[model samples]
Target: MTATISGWSAIVSPRYLGATVTLCLGVALLAFNGFLVSTALPTAVAELGGVALLSWATTVFLVFAIMGGAGAALLKERLGARMALIAAASVFLLGSLIAAIAGSMPELLVGRALQGLGEGIVAAICYALIPELFPSSLVPKVFGAESVVWALAAFGGPVLSGGLTETLSWRAAFAVNLPIGAIFIALVLLIVPRGIRSKAEGRLPIVRLLLIGAAIMAVSVGGLLDSPVLTGLCLALAAATLWSVIVRDRTAATPLFPTHAFRLDDVVGAGLWVILLMPLAQAGSAVFLVYALQNIFAFGPTLAGMVGAVMAITWSIVAILVAGVSDATRPRLIRIGPMLLVAGLGLLAVALAMGQLPLVILSQVLIGASYGASWAYTSQTIMEAARPGERDRASALLPTIQSAGYGIGAAVAGLIANSAGIAAASTPEALTGVLVMTFALCAGLSLPAVWAALAMTRR
Candidate 1:
């Protein structure tokens, strides 16, 4: 049985408030960075001139984020939480500074890679720190606070980041991170004790990291190739390389994933598949959305950002609404999420073809609602289905796997859009046709997620 707590005062009290604020601030930094990049990249492209390499910016960051996350626990063990956080914040600050002063897309990507590494380590460490900083009873409250931070970021990020991009140079958006990072570090110093250090078990899979990196780069450049045969070969190579990672990791000395991973016949495996594939399909909106809104519809940065923000708002509200859903009914919600993703993506294609803004907004609602309705339940299924000893490892893999999906998905979207002439789409009609094809491919990617989600409903 769980311990009893009458109210949230135990968490909100002055004793713990600074620590609480630091945790929330960490979440804010990551959330704001994501929304800001999505909203401002179009502007950055206008100034920096890399429309062809647009998706590469995001793909690069996600790849490094995954890499950094893989090593977070090791950092904490070696450095302790206080020093670990300080170092992470410093890295993030350096990345932001580099990005602010960047003159070209390639240089900006270098900054983004560093930004990804810093943010990735910080995100993972924040989760690990929860148990260390709070009593078991208060841990739930800490997580609850984190969820609120995410919701607030979803609501405010577009507004804040969009305004920064419009009123100042796009550089100002990255500059905003500097102050936030400073505050996070200050509070971390004042609040967190020097955590105990221990020897970390196992080494990072350097070979696997390289393999995934190569695969992402392959997909990122695949669409840019002039010849159809070369493009096809590149994509095939990416798929095969990714498959090999999964295949080889199962038997590795230091396994990258749990033993049951990717086994469709196993429930946890099904849940993991759903996690990976969902973001893969959803990356289309993250990559192409602002450009389409700005170029085709002539939306200002703030307005275009708001259009994307609606999805996050819808997701937060829907997730809260469904939190109380009976266990008996939760599986049904899990089953519906990916199906809605497929439908929402399909609708985006239809909206682009029909040239309808209202339809686009409606599709966004469906996509957001799908995640809100299903993500928690799907995660619960995976955790519940895991072998007893694998629970913590299963939990750690979720975010990393989700990042894998987005990184790979962004690369694939690049391939598809470039193949459809996104690199040279100067006219509204040309851009529209390319987006239509891109979303259609996203919809197809979403179909496999439906099967994975369906597997979660089974025994």
Candidate 2:
């Protein structure tokens, strides 16, 4: 099969089109859930009476997502991608239903956990399938197109969430996933062709997998708990479990994460840096921005939602522009992306300090642009670095790391905000301090990416 094709031709190809659309729909659903919940969550917690467990709503999903993603190769090896995807979609749908009707905080968390599992599996498989479905030359364009789907989901989700909450109930936010999930499942069944299944797997280490999952869950849920003692203990246990897993995986015939994935070489190093820091800079700041607008600027839910939408739009535009130029000079684009991110976050921080809501909104445009360029370049760089056969595993690992990073960043930020008493303070001073901290974190994260990009360009 040819590895290179023109962008226009790739888009029109029947196989490529089918796979892209199916993957886009699946990813869009995931993005929509993430975006909608961010807007609706404050209200959800108020109604559910579990402000303590608030962060769990996001962190739990991320923890399971990493575990599910890590286990995806094992599952796909045992059950084929087609079956794996179907199972994931079904579980996601079930989770959505549970969350939609959850009577208590625990039930809602349970639903979120299930959804996270499904999301992880689906995301890993979708990424793994990309190289198989498209030629090498077409991968960038196809992946770039997928970014558009994510952007749309991000842009529309907040608006929809705000409107739905105003017109109906916050539970209705989850209800939106039902139809999307059903359609994604249907399309995958009808369009995705059966391919050669993986044959190189021993029995899955159920105990180790469970340990890893529990460790991730502990850290995620622990971060949300009000008790610092419990959170610290859970984090310690999580660290221990991770250390044990690393040791065991080294000796195991088959491991959850590929052994070579951790290599600190140029391409792999750059890819991992992007994976870890993108969320730290992007999603982490997003949490702060949303709260800052609501609490400090006195923006209603609808206006805050609109600000987020603008960010998403800018992200899409930058992604497309970067994709168009990627073939000619990927390393250069990668280098510049991080600098843009740093500048954006700097502007955002200054705006918050000055109590300028309008300026803050403009800063989001900068953030969005940086996110777009960096995300596309990072993904392509990772794909390029992997061995041909290992692409699936590499792709699967990307999202797992991304989700894990987001969870860690948010959890850490939450701890800081909570400890400083910023989360509860109704005053603008507290809000500004929190926003400043978030921006500082984002800016700090971007600096490393800048160095990574420069290193890549030098090569």
Candidate 3:
């Protein structure tokens, strides 16, 4: 039954109901955990007394998650979707339990790494399975609904974690993951088909995996340290290692990213650039924006979270509504989307300079809505450009690139702020100056996205 997607209806249609929920849960779990942990980590650090190792929680999780994403195709081939998801959920459950009962920072870090592995694998699987399970016409709808899950988690994760930490204990936050994991396992077993598994080909790329991990670690560790010379050295080393890995992959018989992925003129390449740059631009200030809200605007945690969520909330609603756009309108929307992102960021920079909270919130909504309007189409473009056997690899590319951009962006942003004296400034005037500088720089990043979108149009 190839039903034309008129709206969100395609997702809720009888044939897709089970698959829809299953896919949504796979991603929602990842998103929820990310936000929840960020909110609850302060309390955990306070209790465990590992303030110095605080950044390691996020750094370890991200590095392992990227590793999981890179190896996802192999896992799927070896275990099949049903078993793969089950394994991921079980690992996630174990990690949650370990973290919940952890006595020290090291123990929690180990548990976080495990959770990252599971989360990354599940996220990659969600993308890979979409093409396999759904009709082409309905794929956008599935992506839209998945974005909604992400948006909901963005809002809900912080609130739930904050409430739990304040009212109960930070341990209670991790305990909640138990039920979600259980439900995810049940849904996968019942709804997802046990498809025939193919023979796993090739040994795991041990050397390439090591290179990727080293690069991420070097950059991450470098970013955390206050020494400029060390940060520069680490960041440079990370760049060289990343470059070598990409070059090696390109020449290999089985590459992680297809050859087209590296080309600027190709559809997949353009879409991939859009994916990378959007996050790069946003990450430059996304973390700072939260603090700015509380520090400069004097918003409470709940209120600041709501303002912070404006982008995601608008993203979900816009994505849902735009799922029904006509074919002709999609191209125009795609082109305009990056420009809207530019506008949104620009407005945000202006809002920060003027100290207007409402404008700040409005800018976030525009930025989020721009993503909602553009991402599905860009993602589709990437998949469409992939060779038949390469779609699984393509599925993993967007998220990997996006995550890398985020990590790198935040690191760069910190350097920018530190250099500008924002890191040491105590006055509200100094805080605003740093934000203005940071966001203005971030806003400029959208120009490359515009260029990428234009490149896609030429093709």
Candidate 4:
């Protein structure tokens, strides 16, 4: 262990316990909202009688979140972290209220969109604030603690969603956020000291931000549209809009993302690679597993959900353990993490081919552990590499790559399954074949991440 790690390990004493809890609660609220929505979304769609639009709810939030995260970085530069957090919390509260009271699907979506904006800003600020608040030696440990909160949120999110939907209503799930958001905002103001205000870099263009947000919303909502051709066109427009943003950023005096991020430094590039590959490997396998378990094994929704939770629980546990270790050895852990992921995915492919459920579940456990450790390591690595002031800009790209990778992976898997004579509805043989192909692709994509990890040490 390095001196830095040893110091951080010692800093988690009784005196700073209050500050630590406050920080964890604030970050956990953001993640709880994210996970809760995913759990309750199915029920929401069923009630609204628009099952086709189910995916839109998740996609739209992510799209808007990208824009919000970028904007928050800029806002933090102007208003300072403390004030920026206040603004984000307010927006989140209002959005939660809107979601809870919404009468129609469109209205509910509007609320969700607003919530996404708040989520994006708050998430970026959280990453940006960690380095500023904690000593350099303790930053990684703080981030690791945050990851534990995220894991808890991920584990608890679905269970809460299921319980809320079954007992009360889906509306209750959104309503729950109001009180939590309020409490967190209060705690942040009371606990965190106000620092020097951030020096502004002129003003951000509101019109440009709107254009980006609109383009993302169109892509997500379009996907929900029944017309296949229209959906394709919308996706094309989204792509063009993103490309324009990239071009503009290259030339702009103050870009939304830092210039070097796109240039791909060893740590940043490794972070991006993990962001892309982990999601692809995890999500693709997940969709396939859900199908195989429910169709092949004839499991109920409750049972299937429990099986899914196993992966998340194991991932969280591994992340916490690895994060607590010393920084000098962290780099090696990063390398091993991705390699294990690739190996786990490969094993899953073989298990699928052999028609063995036990083997498949075991593969999931390994993959989950790899994912947990990789996520924590990558997050810490990116924070370590970024310039002090540009942390938010760099961190914003991580989520964007993750969301994009998962979407692309799921779509590609769907196409492959359909083309291979598997109908949309699941069957034992068809699902088994889909799992085989999906795992194979995930294993292959993970190879590049391994290479990226190797490159990190050399740099």
RMSD (Cα, Å) of model 1: 4.2
lDDT of 1 by residue, 180-229 (tens): 89999998999877887756567767888788777766765664566556
Query: Candidate 4, residues 1-459: lDDT per residue as tens digits?
Result: 565444544446655555666667767766888878888877788777667666777776776776787677777777777788889878878888888888777777888878887877777777766656666656556656776777678678878877898999999899999888888788778766565565656568666677777776765555345555665677678669866876787667666765545344556755666666667656667667766777877888777766766677777677666656666777788788788888888988898789787887788788878876767667767767877666767765555566656665555455445445455535677667766776787788778777767766556
Q: Report the Cα lDDT for candidate 3.
A: 0.82
Runs in model 4 lying further than 4 Å from the true structure: 1-15, 199-201, 205-244, 424-426
What's model 4's lDDT at 448?
76
TM-score of each: 0.80, 0.87, 0.95, 0.87
Which prediction has the highest TM-score against the true structure?
A: 3
Q: Name the runs in model 3 displaced over 4 angstroms.
A: 1-6
Sort the candidates on lDDT, descending order: 3, 1, 2, 4
- Estimate the Cα RMSD of every predicted model relative to the unseen true structure: 4.2, 3.4, 1.9, 3.3
Give one digit per residue, the lDDT tens place, for model 2 in 256-370: 6654554445576556666766676666566677767888888887687678677778887777766656466777677777788888888888898898877887888887887
Model 4 vs. true fold: TM: 0.87
Q: Report the lDDT of model 3 for residue 96.
A: 89
Better of 1 and 4 by lDDT: 1
Between candidates 1 and 3, the one scoring higher on lDDT is 3
Error of 3 at 157 (Å): 1.2
